[model samples]
Target: MPQSNINRRTVLAGGAAVAGVSVMTAGITSGAAAAPATGLLSGGRTPGAVIPPSDPRYEVLITGINKRFVAHPEHIKMIRSAHDAEDAVRRAFRQGKRVSVRSGGHCVADFTCNPEVEVILDFSEMNAVEYDYRRRAFVVEAGARLYNVYEALYKGWGVTLPGGICHSVGIGGHVAGGGYGLLSRAHGLVVDHLLAVEVVVVDARGRVRTVIATRHEDDPNRDLWWAHTGGGGGNFGLITRYWFRSPGATGSDPGKQLVNPPKRVIAHSFDVPWSKLTEAKFTRIMKNVGSWHEHNSGPESPYRHLSSLFNVNSRAHGRLSLYTQIDADIPDARRLLDDYLAAVMAGVGIKPVATTKPSGELAAMPGFLEPRELPWLAAARMVGAPDPVGANPEARVGLKSAYYKKNFTDHQVATFWKYLSDPTLTGVDSTLVVLSFGGRINSVAEEATSSAQRSSVIKVIFQNIWAFEKDDDRFMRWIRAFYEDTYQHTKGVPAIDDVTDGCYINYPDMDLADPQYNTSGVPWYTLCYKDNYPRLQRVKRRWDPSDFFRHSMSVRPRN
Candidate 1:
């Protein structure tokens, strides 16, 4: 992952599809969604600020990171606090206008910016990160972004949340979506440390009030907390803030409440030229990467200190890359990284040597490309893999994700090789990214949190990034065909099986709901929630009986 400059355009791009209402509480890593605010009180009971379509900020606010989706809402309600959100939600309910809640606008689906959405409750104004002495936990507002949250937590208390890797992703949908990133393997999902969430909800009687949900079993709102653990965003209500304190954290020290990532980390990257990579060699390389994770990604594995992303770029790119980071605190960290690289390059016969030999910092670190140590905070700022989605701000991208419980089968490897190596599919950027999963993430029981795929060791993303609207169809066709071919045996969807656990809600995809695409009869909800769908539906029925907050793939209340 390279540290790329995050500009305003990238900052405003939030993933659109998340839980329709909101959720609070729970440790969820991996999937990106929103974070909750304080349940105890609204900051100053701030008033909702209205921005009409006529306003200059209207177009900017209405447009999300993905240009694919846009809304012509009558107005936008910018919430500075939970009370503001309550007012906005209540107004929308009374006015009979459909509303969408937006945090970071980089969503994969059109959850926010869409034609059907009449109004958007923009939580971007509610961005705030602080340790609440009264709550005895860190409070990350729904509007908070990943980079700011990391800088605030690390700078203020030297603590961190194991959440999204993208710098500009919002906390609103990200926290509830059970998002994870580089640090997740070492700590756990960000939701794992969640203590409580504050959300604004419209009751059965059309009355909107702010509710505080906690993980306390006896708490009346415990179900709300459970739903948000990994349930995605906007399902239950509009989450205002999230309180995070480690599972067994005690005493008054907020600094001790969250996990402290390594002060520094060793970053590594390697490139395999397409020209030299034969089909046989490619299969071996991909298999080794998966098998390595299958072997080393366990709750107790010392390799948990490491995380990597293998970017299987399209043939047009000429080279494939793997980005990695390992906590430098562990003994034999360098050797461990070396062995990991050895495994990836084992049978491939691609020996990487420094062009001009070594000197200075390069002398001690022996490996391909640049492998060096840097402050952990700096590492969090780097962007990779999905970076293509945000690279141009104007880039249109399509993505599909799955959690792999086991290594890549020979057939799966062959499919990946076919799409990425095919000469005919050109003119667009596509990447089959395999992100390392497992480690402490698998330690949690599947039922412990809303994030159900706990046993998975690999998270796969099939992505295509293109610049022109005219090229959307072609790029989409390529990505879809590639994905379907990879899962041909599973009826074009990653159903619950020995190798594939299912899809991730954070990387929401509507194709799974379309019969034409998902011939597999496995309902879209089952793919994301697995057996947890039933419980989530019950929570939706209880908390959002009116179904006021809804979106594609939102939890449908069980009869």
Candidate 2:
């Protein structure tokens, strides 16, 4: 979770695959097959604009953050100015066509890049970041990538904002969904620092108006700002830009807010041959780690400087590896590593052979190697709240998650082994990840932002990766079954209740809405939004009452 400088080449290269669409065929068809024209309203002229599928630049405009999901949209409009954006939305609403907004296009559910859409308001053209030295704030366009924002702020003002780790994730959705990163434990969610937002909201009359809401006490639209914190994308409105509030008294100048990227982030890998790990060791690791997470996540823990993420992979020489980031220098980092390793060793009752390598902050953001070569097809299940972080025997590809109030437990440790033993349940390429949560993240109150899951201790992401597209059904079913089975095991069990939040928005899977998978009738938003769903619904009603920007699991306005 260490911060890294934005590597333009990597980003451009990563984005090139999708951006390299064939211009020759971009607008060869007319009628339904042809792309729609720019939905910009008249009189809102802009310096740079690409309207409709007929434009020669259309092919370059429609590509998204995720190439896997990008397809030919009926229409794509690239807007550079806020006025251009407003005109596009107003035009789309007037035409009675469905409008889908695309920023990074990283949504796994394909909500932003759906092929059936009539129009796409692509924001990739509006990348800009301006700093107000006097106010200690910065204005960032939604199109900027997390890495771009990081580099621009650091190089221009020596400041950083807490955002996602992935260099390709667009700031648009990241901030809207409550951005979390290594810095989150120290600075809180991105919305915690959001001071104001410039949004283009569509009214019931199909008119688009620009609204500016600030975090000031007297700002009447403060609730609107709250809704954007973690409300998820396309719910309230199209956020054209965001103004970040300055961190309080980090230092007199920008250097005070900057942490010299960690000198070395030690990464350790341990390949626990499936046969060598016992149920006891697995359960112990889960429980101990879960317990440790709970214990240190409380209001009093100073462990924010130390964080760890464990990946249990079912394939690629299957291994259980731990990656930890220590905020201290080299010597203290060694001690931190020793202490953490000792805790895990004691809980699992086995000495894991670990290889520790030092890496810079940039390497940590995207990893030393390219993740593009990594498998794209993967499915995951998450268990949250009050559950003992133990593994479940019935889990076919089980992903058990927990928010520790203290440290992990012994029971959870044993469960890890039992869950991974069933080869039929998990293929050779599955992974179980335990990511660090809390720390500085918990310092902020639940009401301070839209991400109400602030009290969570840790997040367990059980994921399975596959090589062939044909195996998609099999792998997904396995993951879903594992999730259901784990839930059953905890049903009516101590400390486990119906309120268990289901999953993260970034890993969207609509199966949670199906009665077969979620018999609890706990709407999808509850898993991602917790108690903040209602407020989000109001925002949805106010902005997109017609439900133009919607997907299977999008926030639904209350009837």
Candidate 3:
């Protein structure tokens, strides 16, 4: 793979070293609730599919999204429904084995593919999307990928759930971690529309049962539902299904209740040659983005209809680019696009930014490369395609993330430029991507859900993709150094301070929890969940008193 075109899979599901696995035998139970031979759970028929180490598909099932950390579970059980999931959990508990759940197989960290994971409950077969009359919302099974969810919703009722751009991302973990996407600025987060969830949880007595929790104010299990929203997955239980109905939608008619899919989408790509970029120029471009998003990120801002990603590739990559999209059905979309582009380059110390149609050719000048318009579904598919480099078994990647309340300081900007332009940093494909944030999402109260990051204007993702295991140390050291330096003001971590609002939980970096790396004097949970951590701990205690499901970054039960 070319170093410039990094794989999205690697970007999303990087790798980490395996931590020691802990064993627990107190929760064991095998007599009455033993999983039936028919693979039937309490409510549904599961396939009872088991792929042992000898099975040919075991290797494929064990390969994570990044193809970096390949787990070797004792066995893999396929879950077809909530009942199946519960059965799998019961068996794992009875066997005194640690259980790990895999939905889309895209966890960025080693949460599900760790050494402690003995039994793997694979949800790949449980994918199903349909409207549920009783729930008055769309019922999405945990195994469903974002692409399946989008297609099902759009085709079934001309509605859409604004989610991540990756089609292959599983809804199980995505929604649980407070999923966001291109339209998040306009529609808020996917969690904003979450109404209920079906989870298979182990009780205090070690009994496995499925619980359906909803957002209804009087629902006895309301906290369970709230914990699923941005609480991050694998904390309380294994999520089996999610019910989505936009908040305030009273009608049971799925078509009329949910947000309508965009009528059309306009996709634009801007390519800036490295020769045209300087430290000052780069700083100006980023400043424009930071200030623009901060000022315009409101429920009523016209710019909320726009979302763009500024991908700053290392100077070694020889170019920088912007991927932009907008709902064309909005009024004055053309003018909005043009004005936004103009504003980004307004003070970048560059002249005559060129514009042209996408001609399948490299741009000789710094300007918009290709401007193509497509129907909503087509555009969505194009955006979510995985990068081929991710399939390379030899490739390994590492990721780190942060949310910014405002523009980067001069020092931060200079640090990025210095690292990117460094002559010594070579071979690794590194990039700093700035995603547009804060719009309708900020309209919601931070305390309303587990996702407490409502004030940030921009979210940053730091990535380093390399082709050799030998380069792991070098790549990790480079990325960590970059991240530490970027947040040096906060003691090498994005603590809840003036410039940073903590980190995104979905990124799941264990380094933030290690005192050796995080000298910020702030607990990693504070950086990931902020004030919501206490509430999460309470819910964790209530729902998972035995601490059944957990990982390095999973929420801890109250002491």
Candidate 4:
């Protein structure tokens, strides 16, 4: 999607009613809850931690990015440092409780906030992005959000990590799941620059210790670091911090060595009113998008710095929007952008309209708006808003995702249009967000990291955003049916086919692991990890032999 700055305030601004806890009927729990208490850990109070279900902040603490699942942990430790995280893990082990860690609280799946969790280690307060001279890398705490990392890295050293656009998405999960954003086309995935990681792991002997793993060969714990590279969170251990530096980057001159942020960026948008959109028009648009990306998304493409998000909203939403951005530093940037758009129109047999063309509520032609130029930081701050249209971040969300090796097939495109054009569906907030993927990101080998889907050209996110509890069933049913039908030819889920590469682990869907929902016969782990599943499982066995860290979709030990 178009890169936008996501910060804490905007992320929590709007959404559905406060979520309720999904308590597992038989999980371990503390006996009869009393008044709020502290000192849940061995040390006195552990600074400012709070044992939950009793503390006033319990509800807020467990409410995460999706708001669909609420955790009811017996204890919520407000961890301020790595020591705090280690201590919390030790406590969970001693108490025989299942532990879950929260950073930006953005897991789409119920992994972080389910009833199975007995202890929650909150890292929200530990957010810090700084240059570590000793390590020769930029150190980002797991709790730090993308916006924070961007701002800090840009202002301090003129470098940044190519991560997700959501500002409030914590680095912990984002990087662990192979973080990507608009810059991914130019810088590759975040894991490509990952140099080292600090994690709190539990051994088979039940001892909790902090381990620093790195990409360096001599490092005995190098495999541990490899697992963190797109292995997904809540698998082997609780990550405390990550260190980033471009591969082969040397010297202390951060500005001269690491990837620099675009000096300036040009942002542009076009609106295609739904009223003017027929099935043919929609098909043409999808075809144009697919064709354009297929041609331009190569490691050496001159348009690598340009990326756009095509948001196909349902008919009830009145309009579909396309947001595009390009590095203004490139020569004749305006002409490049114009030519790119013109080429897209050509692919669909249409003429470009004037930049200032006035658009009606449902214009037959896309109305292009004047492009705006902003400095790197200014653009990031403006673009970083969670929603492209700046919607409230508190909106409850359900998401399903897929990676495309090429473009949509004719059947898939028709299926999309059929469900999206359905007048009977009531969730107007739902949309299909197609993000431009590939470029330098694809240059990496599939086996280099756990994120094995290296050749995808587009990333598709199926989203349902709503605000009412009563509408939950309706929204869920709508999204589920839409997804099922879209992939009906593939056994109710996206398998590794010519058109699909399963789903993104970062956008984890429990349905992929459920036999009731996934009848494709291909295991969810294979869908997400492909050939990397075995290595990840081995890492899990080594770091968490007791299976101390786990979730519904966590990597399991080899049988």
- Candidates in order, TM-scores: namely 0.89, 0.76, 0.88, 0.87
What's the CA RMSD of model 3 in angstroms? 8.4
The window of 10 residues in a row where model 2 has the poorest summed lDDT is: 375-384
Which candidate tops lDDT? 1
Residues 11-59, candidate 3, lDDT per residue (tens digit)? Answer: 1010000111111111112222112212112223435589999999888
Preferred candidate (TM-score higher): 1 or 2: 1
Query: Which scores greater on lDDT, model 1 or model 2?
Result: 1
Mind giving the per-residue lDDT tens digits that candidate 1 earns over 1-559?
1121222112211111122333332222223223332232322444666999778888887777677778899999888666567667877899899989898787878888878889998877666676766456777778887888888788888899988777767888888988788888888888889988887887788878767777877676788888999999979999887878889888978789899889899987666777888899999999999999999999988899899877777777666777778999999999999899889989888755332321101111235366888889876665422344554667677889999988888889999989999898774357888888899989999888999989999999998777789988888898889889899999998879999999999898889899988999999999999999999999999889988899887888777
TM-score, structure 1 vs. true: 0.89
Global lDDT for candidate 4?
A: 0.75
Q: What is the C-alpha RMSD of each candidate to the true structure, in Å?
A: 7.0, 11.2, 8.4, 9.5
User: What's the count of clashing pairs in each model shown?
Assistant: 41, 40, 1, 12
Residue-level lDDT for 21 in candidate 2: 14
- Model 4 over residues 111-147: C-alpha lDDT tens digits? 8888888888878776756555444667677888788
